[model samples]
Target: MQVFGIAEPGAPAEEIEIATPELTGASVLVKITHSGICHSDVHCAEGYFDLGDAGQMPVTDAGAEYPFVLGHEIVGEVVAAGPEAGVEPGDTKYIVYPWIGCGECQPCRDDNENYCIGAKRNLSIALKGGFAREVWVPDSRYLIPVGDLDPAWAATLACSGVTGYAAVSKVLTEEVDRPIAVVGTGGVGLSAVALLAARGHKNIVAADVNEASLENARKAGATATVLTTGADPVTDLVTAGGGKLAGAIDFVNNGATSGLALGAMGIGGKLVSVGLFGGQLAFPTTVMALNQLKIEGNFVGSLPQLRALVDLANSTELPKLPITEAPLEAQTVNDTLQGLAERTVVGRFVMVS
Candidate 1:
């Protein structure tokens, strides 16, 4: 099988050939057909995350070798399977759950491998990822059938789609019409907005530094959009939130957006931080105590959440965020990573095999 990956930190992805591993136990091999290029992939290629004040946090393991294959949002057809693997080798495609973990861990036992405490088995991180012609999955259980969903869009459900779904689910309240802010209108942010609208939420405020992104947020069902480029961005958000935000999800959980989300919250508001943009957040303890505000961080999502999101996509007409396709090649992968790093990608970029 051939793969494209970062040969060195801060270098463009390059092509490499490797021998196909033999399947065992419940293991299954998938022939890659569609994979989404995410912003996290850019961080993977760069080898470190920017930690605003403290320093850079390296993602590279000292013991791990270079040319790390970076792609997690994956979907493909089953090509080969172990004797116990349930799926058959055919044209049917399934979205692979890339957040693998030690099945013995408590979180994994609870079917929430995204929160696994044991040895990390996450694809694109601890293992070779899906930016290749094929990926070896440990078990067929992680393969969620795509059904009639668009393959390119379905690829995102493994990560961005489910991440958005889980984050939006965290902020749900009985007061469905209350103002809720979605900070950052990137691919995941837009997904959150659409999910909120689909679930009958009446007031959704989308905030972003880019006007173009804000426009796309409106199309995704945001009742109001705030451009966080003015003198008082928090005030802008609060106004867009219909006086005070009932809840907020910071998709770009950087210093500025985090502050904006926290500052605009009303009493009893909740803030769910769901981005790896990287930064330290300092909020007044007194205000948090007085307002009874709750703050938490969210990883991608649980296995069940991914399955639920796929079901929702199949049942509802979720707004299709612009999906641009590029050939799954070394140069194209590098270009997509560069586009993500520069914040130029409007929606999602899917690589086709």
Candidate 2:
């Protein structure tokens, strides 16, 4: 098997040859077809997340190690399966749900393994992931059948798509008559815009520091776009959303975007922070109490949510976001990561194996 992975923290990923993993005890082997490079992969490779004034949160704290294979957005064909594995080898393709957990924990037992705190068995982190020609899935259950969607696009559903869908789901669960604000017009933000439109949300205000990103959001069904470069982006968002936003989904989840989202929300509005662009949030306690605001943090969704997102993608024509495809090579991986870190990449970058 061939893989492109980091030799150590902060080091660029390099191609390395290794023995193909042997399938054992419910393990399923997937021949990688496509893998999406995510922003989190950059954060993980850098070895820590910026925690603002509180300091840095080391990836080591999450049990990440050197020579790590960092790609979670995986779409592949089943090559082999253990006797206990439910899937079989052949033409069937599937998407791997990467946020796995210790199966015995309550969250895992409840099918909310993404929230598991016991042992973080997440792919591309604790386990080897999709940045290779082959990957070992701990169990067949983590595999979800891929439908007619493009493999490269379906690859994103493993992370960005599902994360956006999950965050949007949280805000739309309640009655919201006013336009909703989607902060950060990155891949996930654009996904939210498209998903919201598919779910009959006609009025959406998209915000981003990059004008190109904002344009992408507009193309993805945002009724309005707010450039977060102004003196008062919060006011800009509220104004663009027709004087009052029903709620805001902060896909940026940084200090600036958080503040903008918090300031833009109306009374009883919900703010779902979904990005891993780490930072602390400090707001007035009195305002939160008086306004009855709901601020929640959303991780990458559960299995059921992934299923729903897949069904939704199959049922509707999802607005196409920009996609850059590259061959799965050492130089290509390094270039992709560098492009992402430099914020030069416009949309999702999928590596075809």
Largest TM-score belongs to which candidate?
A: 1
Tens digits of per-residue lDDT for model 1, 241-302: 78898999999898878988999999999999999988888889999999999998898998
Specify the poorest-scoring 10-residue window by lDDT in model 2.
170-179
Provide TM-scores for the models: 0.94, 0.94
lDDT of 1 at 50: 81
**Model 1: how far is 115 from its true place, Å?**
0.7
* Shift of residue 277 alpha carbon in model 1, Å: 1.9
The residue pairs that clash in candidate 2, if any, are: none
Q: How close is candidate 1 to the true structure, as a TM-score?
A: 0.94
Residue-pair clashes per candidate: 0, 0
